[model samples]
Target: MLEDLLLQGAQPNYADNIRAIAARWEALIPPARLGDLESGDLQAGIVSILESGEVTDDVILTIAGDLASLSWWRGPPLRDDHRARLNALTRARLTRLADSLEMAPRKLPRSQLRRSHVLLVGNLLDPLHSPSGGAIDYAAALASDTAVSRVEIVHSGEVLPAMRTYIEARLGGFPASRGVALVSTRDNPDFLADILSRGPCTFHVWCEPALSPAISLVSRLGPTLMFTCADEAPVQFADVYWYFQSEAHIEKVWKAHAAPQEFIDRYVRILALPSPEPRPLEPMSRASIGLPEDAFVIATVGNRLGVEMDEAYITGIELALRSQPKAVWMVVGGLPDYLLGAFEQVLGDRFLHVPFSRELDRLMTTVDLFANPFRAGGGNSANIAVGAGAAVLSLSRGDVSSLVPDSFIASDPEEYFRYLGFLMDSPELLAAVKAEQGQHNARMRDQGLFLKEIQGLVRLAADRYEARGCGAPLSTTVFAPLTRLAQAG
Candidate 1:
């Protein structure tokens, strides 16, 4: 069969395979570095892999897996079974590779054993660069962990000048040797390959459409445990998922999406990540964003990052804005032109756009209330609003419930509308809700919820490591002894 394909120029030789792989691999690597692959270097490398006298199944399998992962961003484009074939090969060859290439205990110093190396593949790298609050905060929390030895951030796209400074201070400032590497998947995906190739320690991901390739590829390589922070439960690719709300709500969402009950039971990890308590949001007014002093500001967050929005949602906002004349909808963050235009048209001068800010926590305090963005949902935006002591109102429930005030959770659309109208009619009712929310916010911050979740994740990851029989590993968890390290500057 191989001979026949070659006869008709179906494959031709190893060079064709390398070329085809390299073309698709463009998506995975830095655009600038891609020239070398097309200049015959990639094929030459492939030749060496095939001709090396000491080649093992692991060597071939690694190449196959890389190509498969690069090509199958979603699952093969059409009939290209490259992903499936490579996955099977990698799994078959993994044990042999893991056993032979395992890092020795003696070689690792005692200090190294105290911490776990975490490779984070997500949108975080710099505040000025991506300005994504969720990823940046999550990375900050993990980096602050005393038990974390190395936190390698795998980011993509532009790295502005400000990004470098932010990383150096927040992430790279860690005391651990080789503490942080702000890696670009485009510039050097090799660092990621090197880590995963070393054997599946674990891959933690925030499941977004953009990361489908990375997540799918990681699934192919060995016995890797993937912990995902996904608002919606994925049908495949992730191993364990961290959901930011109650089990009942998540179960309802999963079942609504047709996720099997067994799958949900096996994979979901209900972890209501705690709110980040920065210094309390300083006082500001409607004048901060060019609105009237008495404008009843309704705050919301948005981004061009493809947050889900529907027409019904547009109607909800339209109704919210029209319900009261003083209602000014202040959106903080970038929005698609269409949505932005819709808001602008509906509210005219009453709509305010504050370009996404790093200090959004402080800015959110300026608003009267944070209306959870209809069906789109909020990430750090909702958290900051609630943490800043502003009441949050959500029409549709999902993970957004984790951050919103209990006094403001609307049961259905009719009730949601009624609540909005009631609040618009009665100033006392709105102020009381906001006050109750402030009390709850104070309690949440005092309890340290976000930090606790990170600590819990470290403990869980450590448990998996020890159970793997990978020597009696020091717990990569925060114990009494490690408390000093946690408090260490």
Candidate 2:
């Protein structure tokens, strides 16, 4: 069955067969990088898989995870037909899942609700040690509401050392009577189900589509909120869709899935998760970093440079440097050798590659302009740059990139380059932009404001769940907004 599905132009109706083929191919050639999907053959295979099957919960989820990893801005684009088919499949699968989860309406009085005990489920790289954005978001959620009596974190994978320290600190910080624990479920569905059965708690799934099967099941237990965190589609099980990006951008994402206007209006809400406060650091000079003291420095900082920094991004830097004599490019993160070689071949000493540093805050002080490549992630770095008083330049697409002020955000490649040139040429204008961004950054980082908003959204989600009479299903055919004709089959 797998072989027949893998054969060129062969279409399969069973989703389980597509899942088998995908699993086999993944084992045969494990993707080393996100850009692996950029290969023409791989893209064709993915499109074929999407077109072949009746989207099952597992297959659609796996495909969504793969699509999320692609550098959509710099791509061998998926055809319109394939995109439409994928969307149709996604809507159909979600509708069926919603129907299956529906239960008889039974109202549980508000007094019986265990709203004080909050449960957060997701994949954290290292909540205790490494301060990844997801980790910070999780921590912030725990600290956001002092009114809550208990916080339970059910995460996948092994609990790292840092997580232990965080748990200790959280326990110490809260009243001795309160409870706090971070348990690793090891991605076991039964274990997760057991945890969910413990109490009537508000659940938040801060995960990518890959983990949807395990985490999405939370909706069956209680009021479930899924933080999109810039992941592609909304999880079908989530009652409320929480996002960090602008409302307009969130609407745009839902619209692409062909969501009905009513579905979006009722479920979508924007809330900025709190980021760690930037600590004070002594400023570093250009010469200290081995750059010309008087040179105009333009830098892009990120952890996944290999994935985000493509050939076009490099070419753009090269063009900007060649055109502006005093302009120098400094990249502060890891990159593949091929990309590094491209940088060296074009601009010799003018390009400075700094390994990921602890003194990133100090280094930001020296930069004149922080240029963000057109990519999916990097909201934290961009916010840091803005707070550090660097004029941030980005294309107005991506969840992270769209956070910049309108004047600095470019609509297209031409505008991006134009904005960069204008900023480089006029120091006065650059300084003004930086000041504007700093103000915006300050507002975004307001811990109190974020906490207030998050608390309200949680209440809102709980209210909606209660209003729906507890276990009664939320949406049925609402997800099949634009695919009703196809869904009729």
In terms of lDDT, model 1 sits at 0.51
Q: Can you write out model 1's per-residue Cα lDDT over 1-489, one digit (the tens) per residue? A: 222221221111233454555444444444553453455434343334323433455345444444433222212121213223333233323322223333433222333333434444454445532233345455666666666656556666676666666555555556755355666776775765666543334445642332234544443332223443323444333334455466666676656545445336535453344333356457666566687887788776755222344455557767877768888878776565656677777679878888667777678767777776544335456666766657677765755666555676887766776777777778899889878876765655442465566455544544444443332212122112222322221
Clashing pairs in model 1? Answer: 30-186, 274-450
The candidate scoring highest on lDDT is 2
Once fitted onto the true fold, the runs of candidate 1 whose alpha carbons sit more than 4 angstroms away are: 1-114, 123-133, 196-202, 207-230, 235-239, 258-263, 266-277, 304-311, 314-325, 332-349, 353-359, 439-449, 461-489
How do all models score by TM-score?
0.62, 0.80
Task: Give the candidate number with the greatest TM-score.
Answer: 2
Model 2 poorest 10 in a row by lDDT: 5-14
Task: Please list all clashing residue pairs in model 2, or write none if there are none.
Answer: 128-162, 128-163, 129-162
Q: lDDT tens string, model 2, 1-489?
A: 333333322221223444564565565433542233444465555655555544445655566555433423223344444554565555555544544654565454443243444445455555412233455455555554555555666666665666555555445466633446565666554665566465566676655343355443455556666666443555355567766566677677667755456546655544355566556767788788798988999989876666566667777878999998888899988766667787778788889999667667778888999899877567767777777778888877765665666777888888888889999999899889988888777777777777677667677767877765575543432333434533552
Going through the candidates in the order shown, the clash numbers are 2, 3
